[model samples]
Target chain A: MAEEVILLDFWPSPFGMRARIALREKGVDFDLREEDLLGNKSPLLLETNPVHEKIPVLIHKGKAVCESLVIVQYIDETWGHECPLLPSDPYERSRARFWADYVDKIFPVGRAAWLSTGETQEAAKEEYIQGFKTLEGELGDKAYFGGERFGYVDVSLIPLYNSFYALEKLANCSVAEECPKLVQWAERCMQRESVAKSLPDPHKVYDFLLVLKKKLQPQ
Target chain B: MAEEVILLDFWPSPFGMRARIALREKGVDFDLREEDLLGNKSPLLLETNPVHEKIPVLIHKGKAVCESLVIVQYIDETWGHECPLLPSDPYERSRARFWADYVDKIFPVGRAAWLSTGETQEAAKEEYIQGFKTLEGELGDKAYFGGERFGYVDVSLIPLYNSFYALEKLANCSVAEECPKLVQWAERCMQRESVAKSLPDPHKVYDFLLVLKKKLQPQ
Candidate 1:
């Protein structure tokens, strides 16, 4: 039986981008049905991810897999083995999972940096810099997070590159200056066709975020 | 060499209970170093999990595994596959992961129900009921979340059995009434030695939560 693989995706979500990159890296032929996230979410998305009712859901073989990292793991597990996203060793796989989780959990820092003002924004940028520096320490002369391979952590963190632009413009900070190796790593990741194609343009994302900020604040 | 397995655990944490349960389920003899999480976290816990500075950290043969579900997966993978926590099939494994993710992500709903008061608490309790009813729907008539197997989702959620008492007391509600099957599932899970021995007393947890609430609110 032919596999029916579909992704209920949204273009600007960094979480959504991870799924896109992972699927592309595995060379999976998938239909990306872009979601109308702001105004109206599709019924299929609501049905597939009834728990979260969020995007980047992987519907494969009539089963819905929600959560971007979970979707990435699902894609990695169910699809092409030639390019494995996660490590085969148990400990190494755990490490990959940890770093991906770190990326998932660290979003509020980045959001505060991009969306807030004055003292709160300043503190968040400092924390964001520290967060990236920690990632830099983890990267630490390795070609990628799992050492030389483009694996799970790379797929997880690379999607944040577009967000870096927003932080740079809005927060008036440079991740390049703050965490040199992480920026270098992002550059390396961007060279990959999968990452390059999956991520949205930074300017567009920034504009949308500005509009979102106004909507959120309602001033 | 004998496996040097040590858990950096805290008594009040459902997250910590997950690692404890998973390790016991694998029958891996190990040390449980209870952390003074509210006061001074051990330097080893600090060193092992520098980013989160949290428990439970499952240090297996010098490698530190943070995050509860990830630690559970590590234990399931590294030790005995005799009673596999996750399913063998990638699709089923994804489903297991999805439901486990569901449990991990639903902590805030449960927290709000326990911690807040009046309208906010009432709303959170409603949300909590809806969330568990969703779980009950997914659980169906299955002996566990993954059919008859006491698997990943079961392990992920069963630790929360202790928290049920806190909600019942503080929130003035009953999950046993709203989510009867889920409560029954919790009872079923408690029958296992892994779950029974690992989970703390519900009353103790409730007391700690009350103390925590006072500390948090400064009232």
Candidate 2:
């Protein structure tokens, strides 16, 4: 049976990009169904992910897979003939999951850093930077978090590079200055067709956030 | 080469119980080193889990795997000849992970419900109960979360069943009344030797919490 793959996503979401990149990695052809998350959420989106009611839902062969990391793992497993996202060894797989989990946490902290103010924003910024620094420490002297394999952790994190431009403008912070290695690693990732194609323009993301910020907190 | 396994844990911790249960499920005997998480932490504990510096570190052949869910997955992968905790199918695995992730989140809300006061406690209790009710809906006539197999989601949550007595006393609430199916599921899990032996007496947990609470918030 021919597989019918579809991704219910918002273009700006880093989480969505992770699934897109993973699908690309597996050479899977998928339809991207953009959802209006803020204004009017689609019933399909709600129906697929009833729990979170959130996106990056990968509908493959009629089964809906929610959660970006889980979706990536699913994509890897389903079409695992080539370009494996997670390592074959159990220990390596665990290590990949651990780092991906760490990357998962950064989203909230990074969002808080940008969206909040006063001590809350400052503290979030500090913690977010600390998280990146820790990732840097793990990433020490290796091409990727998987050490020569551009795999799970790399797919988990590279999407955030799209948000970096928006974050720098909004938060007045610089990951490039703090974690140059991460930037270098991301640039290296961009060289790949999968990553290069998946990520949207950061400036567009920044503009959208600007509109969102005004709608969220008016003057 | 003979396999050397050890578990670094704290008795009252549900997270620690997960690792112990997974090991027991795998039928792999290991030395259990109880960590003094409150007092002086062992150097072994610190060294083994330098990143989190937290317990439920499963050391197999001298390499440490931290995080209870990750540790469970590791145990499942390593000693997977019998009593497989996670399903083989990728979609089923993803579903197990999604539910387990939901269970992981209930810990903080449940903790807040028990530890905090007034409005904060009320809100946490509400959210925690809601989470359990959702689990009940998902369980809906199933023999287990995995539908007759006590798998990853089961292992992830059965540890929390140990905390029910402590939680009921501390929060003045009842899982039995709110989530009857969930309570029944817990009882079913309790019948498993892996779960029965791994969890400490809840009354002991309650006493430990009282002492720790006094230390944390003194009069």
Candidate 3:
């Protein structure tokens, strides 16, 4: 029997892009239902993820999978015969998951850069730049975080490309200038059909961020 | 040849306790090297986990795996021969990982409850209590989160039992009174040798917390 796969997602969400990219990479056909995150959440979204009530819930064969990384791992495991996302070796898999998790852990630094101002903004930007250096060190001339393969860490992080321009403008720092290799790496990722299709226009994302910052800061 | 396993950990840490429980559950013989986190971090700990330098690093045959949850997952995948921590089915595995991630997510609320003071503390306590209630709802009369087996979610969460008394006193709430079922489930987990041996005495943890709070927030 063919699998029924449905994704509950918001367009601007990096997390949703992860699921989309993974599904596309795995060659899985899924029904994408755009969510009204700013307005009322759908009954399906609410029911599917009663705990988080967040987007990027992948419903496969009637069971809901929440958390983008977990869902991405699920997609990989289920359709691993085609394009394997995680490495087969246990140690390599642990490293992949580790760096992917690092992406999540460092997000607050970037977030605070945009959402805050003055001393707080300066501190966040400095922290984010330091975090970027560490990430760059990790990248270290590898074509991809997966080291020559567009796999787990690539899928986990490339979504953040959508917010790069907006963050650069708001945070008053150029990621391209700060981490040239990372920017190059992101461009390499964007060239892929899966990532190209999964990501929205960077300009559109910037516009959305402008509205969001005004709404959130209102100053 | 037998695999050499060494754990870089702190005796009081819930995170460290998680790694210990997983190792115990797998019946893997490992040398436990306790770190003086308050003092100087050992050279091995520094070398093994240069990224986080945090406790609960599982060093298996010279490869270091940092992050408690990641280490636990590694242990499960590496020695999945007996007492599987994560389920075999992809969906079940995703759910297990999701709930474990959720446990890590809600932890900041509990930490805030103990760390902060005044209005912030009150807010954190309220948030922590609300989060606990949600966890209790998830528990829903199950013998364990894995339903009759003390598995991933069990290993992920049971370590928090170490801080229950300290959290209760500092936050001005009773977990036993707030979520009776959760407390009961914790008690059930405590009966197991893995848990009993892993956790420190509750009063001792509370005393440690007193010292920690004074050090962190001196008046």
Candidate 4:
């Protein structure tokens, strides 16, 4: 079996970061191909993920696996018994998967809320707040979403949490204040060497959002 | 381990039906708790799925798993080596999961186009058309999304296909004409005994849409 793995990614994409973190955590060495979102994508990315033509396409042994969550699962399964992302227990694995799915569904919509204005933005904010609150409540007193250890759920959730401060600033609402437990959880996740090292700076995200808001606003 | 497994679901929800179909396919005979989405939700539903409070909660030996895709995976994992939803091959499993995730993300948004009116509806229609075209292009000449066998991807996609006629009728557009191959693929799926038995009447779905549209319309 060939061990050649290449990751096509952009720096700010949380989805791409997930694959990077997973690879790093597993102590697997792979080639990282940085993509320019503004310019034409690499031939490798296009060929690898013909359907979506999106980033975070993990080419393992020349086979492309698209979608961050799906790629994460593939990595876990392929590298099973070597720093497992998923739990060995069937029920526990299901629970971990459930949280990852929830994060995938809600995070994009929540992030979009910060980019819009007026009624649409207001509605998005309400939904976003509700989602964060639910996450906070679910966390309760757990050290991580996967109970004590930092597993798949924590990896999935923590990436999105990287944008919370920036999103709060852009929306003019404090997600941290509203969902304290989730905020605390985010902070706790940052303490992990894997998370701390993998995540990009929060201020750069804020700057990016400011530019995005300017570009999106009516002249 | 108990032989009994219960599914909390609503008939109209494609998500719920995914669980029902998976259960039936697995030959797992259990209790079906039909939830009334418009009226009062059961305490069990709330207790079981505290985060989402959504249907398609599969309770096995008192533990509940939410999210349709997650539940499907759970069912497959729990069941002994019989009709497996996921392929044993890691690469094949990744492909199956990719298409399933694609369908899960796009189907509802496409359905929303049918349920809207005026400019909002037009925007949704454009989005739906693009998604449909992509889906069709992806299918090419494959018998199922997972090639020959009607595996997890086929099961995930068929429910959305069942609603296509209803959606086209509601939106006053011919999806079949626009994406002939996809329509044919869907019809092929319907020919299967498992799918034919599991799905509701297509006309009934259109009738249900009329009621939904009326309720959703501004007074």
TM-score of 2: 0.97
DockQ comparison, 1 vs 3, better candidate: 3
Q: What is the TM-score of chain A alone in each candidate?
A: 0.96, 0.96, 0.96, 0.93
Candidate 4 residue lDDT tens string, B1-219: 565698998777788778877887777787989998778999999999988899989999889999988888888888845778889988889988998888877886777788777898888877777777887887889987777766787778778876777777788656677888988888888887767767888888788777877887757
Docking verdict class for candidate 4: medium
The digit string of per-residue lDDT tens for model 1 on B154-195 reads: 999888767888889878868878888888899999999999
Report model 4's interface C-alpha RMSD after superposition on the true interface residues: 1.1
lDDT digits (tens) for residues A1-219 of candidate 4: 477988999878899989888877777788889998657898888888887889999988878899998888888888746578899888999989987888877886776788778898888888878877877777889998878877898888888888877887888756778988887888888887778877899889788778767877746
User: A10 in model 2: Cα distance from truth in Å?
Assistant: 0.6
Instruction: For candidate 2, write residues A1-219 as lDDT tens digits.
Output: 338898999999999999999888888888999999888989999899999999999997788999998899888889955678889888888888988998887889998888888999899988888889999999998999998879999999998878888889999867778999988899999999999999988899999988888788778
Error of 2 at B38 (Å): 0.6
Best of the two (3, 4) by DockQ = 3
| Superposed Cα deviation of residue B24, candidate 1 (Å) | 1.1
**Reproduced native contacts, each prediction:** 0.82, 0.76, 0.88, 0.88
TM-score, chain B only, every model?
Answer: 0.97, 0.97, 0.96, 0.92
| CAPRI quality band, candidate 3 | high
